[model samples]
Structures are given as C-alpha cells and as structure tokens.
Target chain A: MSRAYNFCAGPATLPEQVLLQARDEMLDWRGTGMSVMEMSHRSDEFVEIAETAEQDVRDLAGISDDYAVLFMQGGASSQFATVPLNLLGNSASADYVNTGIWSEKAIAEARRYGDVNVVASSAGCGFTTVPDQTGWKTRADAAYLHYTPNETIGGLEFDFVPDSGKVPLVADMSSSMLSCPVDVSKFGLIYAGAQKNIGPSGLVVVIVRKDLLGKAHVKIPTMMNYQVMADNASMFNTPATYSWYLTGLVFKWLKDQGGVSAIGELNARKAKKLYHFIDTNPLYSNPIDPRFRSRMNVPFILADEALNSAFLKGADERQLLNLKGHRSVGGMRASIYNAMPEAGVDALIFYMAEFAKERG
Target chain B: MSRAYNFCAGPATLPEQVLLQARDEMLDWRGTGMSVMEMSHRSDEFVEIAETAEQDVRDLAGISDDYAVLFMQGGASSQFATVPLNLLGNSASADYVNTGIWSEKAIAEARRYGDVNVVASSAGCGFTTVPDQTGWKTRADAAYLHYTPNETIGGLEFDFVPDSGKVPLVADMSSSMLSCPVDVSKFGLIYAGAQKNIGPSGLVVVIVRKDLLGKAHVKIPTMMNYQVMADNASMFNTPATYSWYLTGLVFKWLKDQGGVSAIGELNARKAKKLYHFIDTNPLYSNPIDPRFRSRMNVPFILADEALNSAFLKGADERQLLNLKGHRSVGGMRASIYNAMPEAGVDALIFYMAEFAKERG
Candidate 1:
C-alpha cells in the first residue's frame, strides 16, 4: 500500500504508524472480541483507555495536577462559545487578542456572552505579525484574556506567550498544540480542535486550570460546562471514544519520539528546511514576516500567477496531496504538521526546486 | 481475526460487514491515498461522502424534503439540551412523557431551557411500562412533546408514537432507530445516538421538519441551532466524519437486507426468541411488561439471585459477550441491535438453556 503526503490544514496528516496500528486492531482490541467502537464507554476497558490518554497528555505537557484534561466533542469552534460560557463567571467583560480569522471568530463568540475588550489586534497590519504587547490595552478586572497562538489561514504565529499579569490567559491552540513544548503553568486554559497535529475531526482537547471549574453561567449546556466535564473526567456523555483511542495512540507516538521537546526540535527543523527552499526559489514567495511565520502552516505564492493551478496539479500527480492554500488566500500551502516526516519535507523541497527550475 | 458477538447496550454491536469494509479501506479510502480521517470536510471526496450518507439516511427512513437530516456530535445526552434550546420556541412549557431514565434526564434538561410538564409518567410502575396516552396531561400550548421511544437501561420501549396534536412530536430513538420501520411523517422530529443500531458513539442523527427552523432562542449557540445546521447540511462544524461514513455503510447494509422493514421483522424475531427462553425457564424472569419490552434491548433476571455472577461468567466463557445488564438495573441484558444476526440469538438461547439445566 502507498501513502501520499497530505498537507491540508486542520483535518491534516496523521502518523502512518498510528493508522497502521489502528488498522491492525480495527476488528478486535486486545482480545476484547469487539472493536473499540463497539465497547461501552462505561466499561472498565474503555475507562482505562480514557484514563491512560489523560495521564499521557498530562505527562507530555508536564501539566500540573491543578489542571483538568477534557476529551470533548464538538471541536474547537464549539469552545468559542464554551470558553466564555465557562469562564465569564460573574464578570461583565472578557479581554480578547485578535491575531487572525480564528481569533476574530473567538472574539465574536465571546461578545455573545459578555462585554469583550480587544486587548490586542494584528488585523490592522493585515495579519502579518503579532502586535507588540506594549501597544495592548489589557483590563485588570476582566475575567480572562483569550488569543489564538497560530492562525492557520494566514500562516501567522505568535513568537511569545503574552503576559496576562494576574488575569488567566486563555488560548485557542488548535493549530499549534503538541507541535512543540509549552509551559502549562503559563496559561489558565488551552484548547485545540484535534483535527490538526492531533487525531480526528470531531474531538477537542481542553485543558482548563482546575480552579476555573464550577464558574459557568447557570444557563449553559452541561456538555459545555468545564467544571462538570472536569468533575466527570470528560466522560459527561458518550464522548468521541474512537477519536480518544486514536489520540491515545498519538500520545504514545509522541512519547516514543521522546516527548514534546524532541518533537519541537524536529518540527522546527522541518519548518526551517521547507522555508529555506521557498525563500531561495524565484518562483515561490512566502509573505508573512519571518518572526510570525507559522511552522505548521506555510502559505507561499507563485511569482507567475497563472502557474498556480499547474503547480498544484503537478504536485498532486507526484503524490504530494492537499497542497492547495486556503481559498481566501489563493496560492499554495504545505502545512508541515508534526506527523510530517522530515523526509516528506525534503521531497517537498525537491519538487519545489524542480518546479521553480522548470518555470524559471 | 476472531470476532465475538457483542451485546453491549450503547457502544454495542456493529455489523461485521461494516467492520470488514472499514478495515479494508482504512489505509487508503477509494484510492484517495488518504484515510477518511485525514481528509478535509470541504474536499469534494469527503463532501460526497457526507452527502451520500445524508441521502442514504433520508432514503432509509423515507424522510421527505421538508425534513432536514443533521449529523451532529455529543450523543443523545447533548440533544437532551439541544432539543429544548432549539425547539422550545414561543411556548412557556414543553411536554415530556417520562418512561424511564432517559426521559427523566431529558425532562431535567428541558426544565433548564423552559417550563417542562410531565404529561405522563411510567415511573409509578417502577419504569416497567409506558403510561397510556389516554392518561396524558399534554398541553396544547406546549412547543413540543418529548419522549424516549426506547430506554436502553430499563429495556422499555414505546410501541406507538405519541400523538401531540398540533404540538411538534419529538422522539429520542437512540436505541430504537433503524431497528424497525417507522412513519417519519408521524413525528415532527426524530433523533438517534448512532451507537446502538446505526454506527459508532459520538455521532447523533437528527431528522427535523423544515418548518421548525428559524424559531430557536437568540441566546442558543450557533452549533446547537437546527436552522444553522439545516442551512449548512450539518457541516456547520466539522462533523464526526468517520462515524458518518460507517453509518452510511450500515445504511447500505440495511438496504441490502431490504431496508428497515425487513430488519424490523428480524429484530422482532430475535427479541421474541430471547424472550421465549426467559419466559419458559424457571430460572429466569423479565421484569418489563411485554408491551413495553424493547425489541433492541432485552433485560432479564435470574430466579436464583445468587447464581447471577456465575451465569454471567459462564455466558462470557461460552462467548455471549456483554450480556451483563446496565449498572442501574443489575441483571442481564442482550442488546440485539441491527448488527446481531439470528444465529447470535440462537447461541444465546443455547447457553441460557444449558446454564438453567445445570443450575435447576
């Protein structure tokens, strides 16, 4: 069997080893006589799988016992509303840092629940870089500050974690989590849609500081209540069990690769190699400033506009799949997520050089 | 690969054909060179999959164009909250027929959204039967009538759809959907958690009459809004894609077996055969009234209570898996979902008879 290097953002590439491992166990898991899909969520077998995933994630992140790891459904978009619902508490306002499309959506959803103060915004600069922290107007009385560390659409990323002072820092890390090392204690909460750099499309991994629990507005749905989710250990209802199982496999994969720090070094190298090719090529140009360029999603444009379609077609023919950029920015993007091997990056660079040489 | 017949109540049994089909395609789906889990939801290939599943469901249920089919996450428990948040429009109270634990939970969740009236309750009968419709105190002013057609834990099912007059009839068919033929036109909405008879956990299927749209309260989250879901065809957010694909396969499996009607007949026969053994044996008894006994889940108790542990152990040794009942009920239950072949029922009976003969 052959596999293509998939670079579509969000529901992007997964480790081939994990997929093969899952395929081998598709019919029966550990002599259980049924697939994980067929096992009850309350069963001891499944509970062990869920608990092990939780412990592994905590260990990978060095997450303190003060934090709760919730394996939830409805993706990160759902958390746009869930964050405000669970964190706004009795406070009248929440502060938001707008970086790109993802942060804008989060800001808009938070407004539905409470007053939102735009503490920082890079939209004024055409989403090219993270605005300097000194220009921001942060509120002391605000419930929490929210931001997206990596904007998958425009390929912009924050190089530094914001200092929230006394306020809890909340971040939508959908495109960036588990890609590198992170300081768990630096944020009040972190959330990610598990389609990118994680497992499947429908699940979300939410890590909320335990102290933030039980403060949701009385009217929010139980499924969206972090406290309730934490209390139940994220099994508030039948979770996306299959996704959780796959994610556990992924956590083990990360561990086998020497945890997040080692993966971070490799991820940095992968991004550096791909960007080096794009930087030196006459036919290709990456628009974002070097400081803010994302490692996971790299959106590059062609010097000759008409070659865009041909470039993508040629890439596909060569079994380099899903390299088309986001529609809003019509060019080409190779999202080199953590699952992408360095060899895949080398292949991408080889193809890009050949394409540029032929076009030039 | 040896496969066991699993009788688990929720994340219960799935069709072996579906499992085999999924296993074969796990590495490369339809030569796309990527697993379905890795494909973008907006990609033509994945969208075709999502559309085909919707169409197949509409075909299987004989659903009309006036109804919208939504593939959602968070299970039936989330829908307990979603139902009221979406359907409790311009009415002070919603009516709920309390049959068992599921209805109890639904009633509690609906009260969080609006006034809920227990129109009829079988709780007085220790949840052994459904309260007759004639005794119901259903309100004409109610926005809708809610009921669970099959209670998985209690093993009671409503054999007839409740008449809500002008009020929209909403039914939770989680454990009962696809097990029988039903008149979709009879109810304003039908929803089923896809674990039992459909596919996997985490995906919930909702079929709603189109007119019910545009009435949800403004405070409701966009993801939970039926109007938004209908407008987006349930790709309002990235859906449980893999689960949706497997359900499509299960739909095809049902169609191959002559659709829901034929499956309904087989399900009835399976339940009847299992019930016959329990009824005839001096060592066993089924508590639920025959009229309310679920076609999908059969809960039976042993006359010699001390033999319960031994009965389950022996059954497991004989390969009758998950015959252990709900934790709340504490007896034995065999969830004969659409995936369970009649041969499985025969094996169950064979074990039950031998165990009884040895014990008696």
Candidate 2:
C-alpha cells in the first residue's frame, strides 16, 4: 500500500521525504556502517548528529545562547512533573491557566509537588474556548505560569501568550509547536513532544532559559533535573538516538522548506481551508471558537450524529486515516500538522463534501 | 562500507535482520498506509504491534502471569529513582550491592528517596570481582534488595542470584538480560535499558511482580508511579511506540533463533572463545576473575598500554569499530550482546590476533 495522509493526533505524520531518507539510511548511516540507533551516544559521529540537530532546531526556532536546547525522553508528560520539580525552587505556589484537558492534567500533576493556583479556567464553557487573560488572577510571586498553548485532545488553542509579570511563562506546545513562528525570548521554558511537529514519540525538545537552571527540588530524579540534562547536553544517559536523529532530519527538511515562516504560511492555509469547508458545509459543525480553534488539530462534528461512522469510513477509504475525534469528545478531528501536505487537506475536504451529499 | 561489528556499550549493536525489517516497513507498516511511528498508540494496528511485542518478550523471558511488564522511557537510569519511589512505601531503607559504576549509580540515586544499605561491596577490589552473597549484611526490613546482575562497563557479573528471602529482589539487567535464561519467579522486579540485548535506546523494559504495585510515595510523579503505568498497560501516556515496535522485532528474532537457552549456549561459546584467546596470548590480558567475567562485555587490556592507539587504528581499518574501552576504564572493551553474531566475534578475534602478531 502507498503512504497515506495520516491524521493521528500524535506519533503523527512525518514528511515523506524524511521517512524516505530514514528508510535508506536504516542499515548504514552516512557510510558509518551503523544505524544512528546503533551508534554510541558519546561517539564523535553521534555527537555531530546530535549537535547538528540541536543547531538546526535552534536556527529554525530562533533560539538564542541565553537558552539551552535539550533533547529529552518520555515526552511532554514527563515534563509535566519536571517543570514543577525544576522551576518551583523555593516558591510555595505556581500559577496555571486551565484551558482544556491538557491544562487540567498539568494542574493536577503540579499539585503533587507544590501549591497549584489555577488562576483561570475554561471549564465553565465546556472547554470550547480559551478564557480571556484579562480575567485571570495571576500571582506575582508564583514560581512559573503554566498553560497549554494547544490542547491536542480538545482542539482548543491559545491565540496569544499570557503575560506572567515576574513569574516565568512555561508552555506545553506538544500539539502545535513549530506549526508557526514562536518567539523564544517570551517564555522561560517551551517544550514539545517530538511525535507531533518534531519526529517520533519518545523524544521531547525543551527550550529553556539559561537562568532557569540548577533550581530543582532535592528529591527530583537526576534525569528530571533540567540542570543535569542541560549540563550533559541531554546525553546524561543514552537518549532516543534514532528519534533524535529523525527529529534532526525534520528540522533540516523544515529549513529546506524555508524555515518556520514558510511552513507557518502553509499550515495556516491548510487550517483555513479545512475550517472554511467545515463552516460553509451545512452537514458539518465544529464547536471550538473560531478565534481559538487549533491550527494543527481541527475537531468537527457531523450535523447528523448517525453519520459519524459513515463519514469516517468514507474518509478511511480515501486514505484519510485517524479522522476519529478523541474518545472524550465523540466526533471527528482532522490533525493536519506541518507534514500534512495541502493536497491531503484538499482530499479530506473532498471526502467530507461527498459524504455530506450522499448521507446528509 | 557494510555493517561493522559495533561493540560500543549501550546503544550497542542490533541484529541486522531487525534493521532490514524496520527499513522495509519505515514508510508503511504491514500495509497500514502509515509508518509505525506515525500511528496513534490507541489505533488497532499500533495496539496489535504493541501487544505482539509484549507477548513475544514475555514468552522469550518466561515471564509468568504474576508479572506486569512495562515499556517505559528514560532508560534504567530513570528506573533507579522509580524503584525506590514506588517500592519504598513504608520501609526506611533498601539493600543494594555496590558492584561497579552502574551499581554505584543506582545506589546513589536510590539513596535520594530512602535510606540505602550497601549490603556488599567489590569497590575495595577496584570492581574486578563480585562480593560473595554469604558475606552480605542484608536487612530483612529493607524495602527491596537491588543488585546489578551484569555490569557493562566493569565487565563483571554475578555468577549466582542472591537470596533476598522475604525481601523482593530487583536486578538491573540492562547489559545481560536474555543472554541466558533465568527464573523470573525469584525476582520482584527486573529492569533493562533496551540498547543491549533489546533494540534501541529511550525504551526500558520493566518486569515487576504484580504484588509490588500501588505502593508509591505520595510525592511520586504520575509517570514514575508503577501502579498507574501497570493499570494502563504501560500506556499511561503515549509510549515510545516506535522503540517498542523495534524491540518487539528483536524479541521475535530471538525466538526465531531458538529461545534463551539456545542463545545462552551460543553466548557461552562466544565468550569462552574470546576469553580463551585473551588469556593465552601474552600481549593481551583481562583482569576480571575468570568465574565472574561478563559474557556480554569482556574488558581486556594490552600488556603495553602504548600500543592502544595502534590496536584501535588497525581494528577500525578492518572495520572492527567501537573497541575502545570506556574513558573511566581505558584499555579495550568488546560488548558482544546477543545481537553480535558469532561471525562478528570470529572477525574481531581474527583481527585481534593479527594485530598482536604484527605489533608484538
């Protein structure tokens, strides 16, 4: 079977070009006679691969020397605990803005370590919209202000970065990172699990300010300590070397496609096309607020609930896989990350139109 | 260049056949129209891949129904802290044997969570031998008794499993798991970083007795909680799916090569052949006690340390790579994990003999 336009929420689609290169180099990488997975993390060759990847991400993201870019394992979920352990040094409380499921998860995990003050929440609205920042009651002495830039499950996204005053701003960009241009200087730390816009599932890229180092709680596991990881250049242990290498390939591919600015334009166009079709077509509806709808994951529902399965079946037949919405919210979600070509979006739109005409 | 005999310790060699299979399936896995890495963890195709891999490992290791196998991230180093965080529920301390660097590191990390009682130590002998179990001063009240079954860097291994009696026994089998068959019923938990006998880094296979679940410290991170992970079938969050899939392929390959018992016989033969050559040759020497020498990692030194560069240079020219010893212990180390075939061993020995004959 030929490759399909995968719409998985995570472990999502990668650029076809990147997958081709990986397949070609699976046996022997760069004439080294070893796959990247087989190479010692400390070897000169792997170090170069690691370093090149770090540099490419840094270049693409416009990260500066003031921040240390770490390639970590266990994804953003691990960082949920790591952020509080590292950033909540002497502070007894931290602020959080609960936008959706991801935000609530972060809030719950943060409560395990220290006081988590949910300065604002969108639960009153059934998580279809982001709460206005003007209504938030953030604390000045809070260690860090945490929020989900994009919630993968709920298809809710923050259209603006919340200002934290003196407190550091930390964003879990797992679903939406690299889909568009992001300013590195605005946040104390920014993290994205590689499965989304990056590469594979096991690796998470953390961009943290240099000053936010060495303040982890005493009981924090060494691996969770951002300081130790940053010091070792994220090679504190054997990393997901293959995942890291693949992520590097993605960063290079993004560069070749004219960096985040160019990809952002393509992403915006893709999201606009799909959302436009959903709104104009009488048979489909999306609950998310138009202003805060995720550009990466667009969740929509069929006008007739009975037609959900048929809509999905037709989409699958046309190679638009994993269009099923998250189980929590029963409908359909089309996750068109940076790797999903515009043609793929066009195909999905075409399928949705045909299904609506025949069934709706 | 064709594949070289990669002997670098962890993130070590993989079976060539496994790499080839992964290459062939990189773009589309089993006609799913998506790479395994791109599949949702909850998707039927990925779930099947995950389940098959889990079942294969269980069969290969002879794990019983009483054990819950967890595919975790952050490697064994993460497990060092996780063991104590979860198991040290009410106990004040855990018993550990300080065999070498790996043991010392585990002990050091375990200490941060609870009192660690070093039951025995081979540090007095520069870690060349394992301390006898009879001399160990283990505490009956200890939360668990932890030991490094095989030390990758020191090239030392325990010839016998220690009798922890009522206390659950934990072993870090990162380097020697599946090299030989072992009775899983005796262990409370067995953890291995999956870069050695298993495939790739960033994935750790944890086999834990079912009774040990649900007893974690209040402050334990959700990701580090054993019960949470077990209850979710190691899908507490999106796991290292691709790594887990590759590891499953390796396990299938192991079964194809006959089970652990057959591999054990082959492993013994390979170790014996390599050690026999090192001991008989006047120019080469291995300091480890013959009985305790690691079958997986054989660290040996040249009689004249000055010939080290020439030895490595000649070996590399012949495509025998990563033979250099760890920087902490600098001579030469050959990590012949299960994936390193007998032919690779023969090639290495042939090159070693030729180098000694010409340079001696």
DockQ of each: 0.73, 0.89
- In candidate 2 chain B, where is summed lDDT lowest over 10 consecutive residues? B351-360
lDDT for predicted candidate 1 compared with the true structure: 0.89
Q: Model 2 chain A, poorest ten-residue lDDT window?
A: A308-317
Which regions in candidate 1 have their CA more than 4 angstroms from the true location?
Answer: none
Predicted candidate 1 versus true structure: per-residue lDDT over B6-47, tens digit per residue: 889889888889888898888799888899988988899999
Record all residue pairs in model 1 with backbone atoms less than 3 Å apart, i.e. clashing.
Answer: none
Q: How closely does chain A match the true chain A in each prediction, as TM-score? A: 0.99, 0.99
- lDDT of each structure? 0.89, 0.93
**Candidate 2: segments with Cα more than 4 A from true spot:** none
Cα lDDT tens digits for candidate 2, B208-232: 9999998999999899898999999
What lDDT does candidate 1 reach at residue A315?
Answer: 90
lDDT of 1 by residue, A1-360 (tens): 379888889688889889988898889999888899999899899999999999999999899998989999988889999999999999989999988888988888888889999988888788888899998999999999998999999999888999999999999999999989999899999999999988988899999998988899999998889988888888878888999999999999989999999999999999988888889878889989899899989999999989988888999888898889887777888898889889888888888899888885
Instruction: Look at candidate 2 and give me any clashing residue pairs.
Output: none
